[model samples]
Target: MPPFLDREEIAPRQQNPKGYAQWLFTQVMLRVNVPRSMRDSFVLEGSELRVGEDRFDLRLFKRIFLVSIGKASVPMAEHAIQTLGDALPLTGVVVGLGTWAAPPGILSLRGDHPVPGRNSFVAAHELLQLMQTADEDTLVLYLISGGASAMAEAPLDASISSEDLSAFYRRLLHSGLAIGKTNVLRKHFSAIKGGRLALAAGAATRCTVLISDVPPGRLDIVGSGPSLADTSTVEEVRRILAETPLLAPVPEAMARFLEQMPETPKTLPEGRLPSTSLSLLSSDSLIEEAIQLVSTAGYRVIVDNTCDDWDYSDAAKYLVERAREESVASIPLCILSAGEVTVSIKGQAGLGGRNQQWALRVAQLIDGQSNFVAMSVGSDGIDGNSPAAGAVVDGSTWQRALRAGMNPQNALESFNAYPLFEALGDTVDPGPSGNNIRDLRVIFVNKQP
Candidate 1:
């Protein structure tokens, strides 16, 4: 496990609501750590691999190969190796968005995130070559997590250039459309996504393990459901393109591929392929554990599941209003939310993520309320264009920024909350978490007598 904020360090800060909020954030992050989740959910019994209740008999396969993609791919592959040993061979590729060093025997490759790049295309080609030789006697251990959609790719048509795909990704990312919508559009454009990878594996038995980063636990949206079956139709893609405001600016080749959509889209043919199974290693399960911990801490906890899709500014307003509506008698209230929020950059770009921007907005709203302390963080330990996981702030944040000769409104307007938080020493940087479970937000409301 990586070095985390020690409980002792947090203990000193816990005397006030501001310090306690940081401690609570650390607790929430600990619950969803990737290695712990993988070990808890997977077990090995001789030649049989048990993932939760599902089991795969490795004795039946002549060879086993691991194909991992996403932010958490390297760690996940590590755990799989620890569990199965020689039962599963590690002669496969692992692609992700971090500086993870793949263990010997496993090929470690870097890939782009938020948008596919040249390296991503190269990784896709490599995976395709490996999948082509997989026969019925072989088994592919497919692992995927958040960011897989952009980490690896093979265009449905060879003519779709990387530059064109990057343009499309930028539009979708800025469109503020839901991830599900964006993923659906992405699957149509990629050869490795939307079950194309599964198809390429042919008759080889596949066991897919997922560390889900999608909301509502939709398996299809996680890493664009690379090794799993996709039930989406071309009509769905068309609908998303038509409904979402220019989310997908189709290039000529991509536009032509849409016209070639098969009557029945190519998905993993479950009945036709050798036996395949899926295990959900983790999801937003951290939210439930986080709620339990907060309740045990004596504060009244209010969990809002609807905060995931709201714009950062809107979410900040709703959270503040909800806190205000609560009765004064219930002091030390904690409002918890888990979900990803969209940030549509305007004017000159700033070094901040959605969480920092949201925290900044909340800071602006509760500028006069010293009892309020709010924080938002990406579980993956990376937030937008900034190195900080996110930002935490209270009523004093505005005054602190003013003291630094910075205008809070100007910072927020430019999507530059990272600098303000850094100056205030309020940014949370935990390094790469080896996990991606969306975003976690905690708002502390402690009314004074």
Candidate 2:
């Protein structure tokens, strides 16, 4: 266990939202990485590993039906099948772009990510068909991760085309609106997200196991809550689209879907329960592991949760400024934080996420300073709009940036952190961490002179 998030724990904060977002992400990651934590935190059960009946029971259930969707779903599904052998008659589907293969008994459908395509539509239909088996006797295991919304598709009532939906999602991903708002728009366009999955599985009793990447751990947001009920209405989706000017208006098809869609029914089916029993399997589960690793390396650890509602660039600037202002002038501390940050792209599409941008921006601010080192990365390894997880920066970071003809401020403004880090060779390449809570930021200010 790490220290609490406050002065009593990690001292105070200049940017509380950034700390809060990171803390929120850390909590989610911590839960998923530790199996025991899963049992303790949420009523988490799978056909494979049954912690207890209250959470999930392998011994109590008979025929099992599994639907694994999104980037994390395949890995989660793979582990689930391996955990439970013949407990329940298992058959399932996994849809995603990653290498998350299916269990022996489970079927898999890989498709596009951050955008929709023909493959995505086909897979979505297949997933809906798979839910046909949701009956009273069925025990459903729903594995959801980030990017599931695009992978598992059910068009808005007007029937948006795959190309159009893909276009819309791409615009949103690049629009710089936060994931929360993006998801609000997504819920309106899709058939399975925003509690749509729970609605589809309305026929059977369901147990939803989720890996939350969103800041606010709303069950309805994770992979659109495949086994959960949705409260977001078509009108709400319309409002989100209207609110964010960066993103285009709802496509004609989606507008029609929003217009024609009926109010949700009160009672949900077994496949879609009245209220699906969903558990947040993990958010920032690895913070303890990270803390253990960092603490063992001979540095103090500060865990903060003020990660939400802050501009990452500004937050990084404040922390660096404050560290420079300290009387000791330098501190040997590893400021550990977690949370997801949003990047609004103002320039031509730059390749990076909020974490990478934060690292680069911090480097620029500390360009004249000495011995400041930091790394901001997605725990899952894939930050945003890039292949690498996040970024790491030190005093020489800007020097390297100059050598490579990369302007740090320009990159930050353009929202292209990955390219800048690439030029400086400071990328934090961990691939996909498999478990995603949100962002992980490690700032080592004046650790070495």
Candidate 3:
């Protein structure tokens, strides 16, 4: 999870907007799950120790292995070590962010993210070597999560550096394009991502178990489908570059890869036969659970939202007005809405991600009505450049800032929400709640406001 979702120290929904969205996000979702029913895909039993069916017996897959990289790799690896313990007979290297420790058999590598760094280059070579030497019996476990884009980068050639890749990736994040478009662009430019990882693991059949943070999940686009076949081509990348001028002058190696796009081959059986076994252990499974729990908590969830035709301003005004309407009826309503949103970033970069920005902007639109509160946050912990996940705003939020002789407008306009919330002492902090589903926001009309 990102830092933005951790702001509220208490239950926020019945009390404020941030709380409701956080509740809907952290309390109801399963960012990771490995049940026995899907055991063939290597059950992630309590986050460690994948129990595979007869399809993958220990004797067949105990050769030298390859553990691919990503954000969730650490915890997933930790759990795997716990499950296998000293009994497992596997020799492999875990290439990922260095902060995580791999048990005695695995070696951990520290890599950078939002962009590849020096360590990423070293890790890339190591992974390339591992993939080359791995035989058909080698069991490759790909640990994929958000931020794998940079953490495990492998440009096709030496012309592109980690700095270049990071700058490119940051531009994509700020582009407001959907994740699909972003990964499509990333796939063409990257050697390790875009199924290149899988192509390397082709010498051996690999099983990829993932916890998807991307909404409306497609196995191919998550972490740019590092271990999956891609139907997208270089010409498509050129088209995106043509349309989104910000991503001009494609790297030469990337252009070459695109021009030389390989033909899609037929699916073959396991045994490193151009095959990859994959599973989605978790996703947006928490929304309905949140609806059930919050609805029964004396708050009426308005379940009929379409989120259509409404700009952020329109949505904010409508929420406050609805709060006013409900207040008159003596009913407190929790307007829960979940989905992805677009941010058209222009000029200088802002300080917050969409969720924090959404909350801050809405704070400006909503009147400090005694009965209203609004907040938003990414289901993941981090938001944009700032450290807060999201925020909660009430009638008192603005006044408290005014009393402190500060300007809320400046904070919202400049995207300095972290400091703004800090001054008010109202940020929700739910450290690493163990799930991601894009972003979640909620407006709660309460009895006490």
Least well predicted 10-residue stretch by lDDT in candidate 3 = 30-39
Worst 10 residues of 1 by lDDT: 263-272
Error of 2 at 68 (Å): 1.0
Ranking by TM-score: 1, 2, 3
C-alpha displacement of 56 in model 2, angstroms?
Answer: 5.7
- Give the best candidate by lDDT: 1
TM-score of 1: 0.93
Clashes of each: 0, 48, 28
lDDT of 1 at 70: 93
Per residue, candidate 2 scores C-alpha lDDT tens digits across 373-396 of 677777665877798777777777
- Writing each residue's lDDT as its tens digit, candidate 1 over 56-126 gives 78777777778999988988888988787777655788998766676677777888887888889899998
By lDDT, the candidates rank as 1, 2, 3
lDDT of candidate 3 over 1-449, digit per residue (tens): 33433334446444455455455555543422222213344443432334343234445555636474665566656555554555446555565544665566677887676667777777777777777776677767676766676666777656666566767777776676767777888887677777776677666767676656565547777777777777676667777877886565555555555566643322423573334444444334435655776787778876423442234445566655665665534666777665555565655765666666666666666646666677666555566666666677766677777789988787766656677777786565554443344555677777762
Error of 3 at 413 (Å): 2.9
Best by TM-score: 1
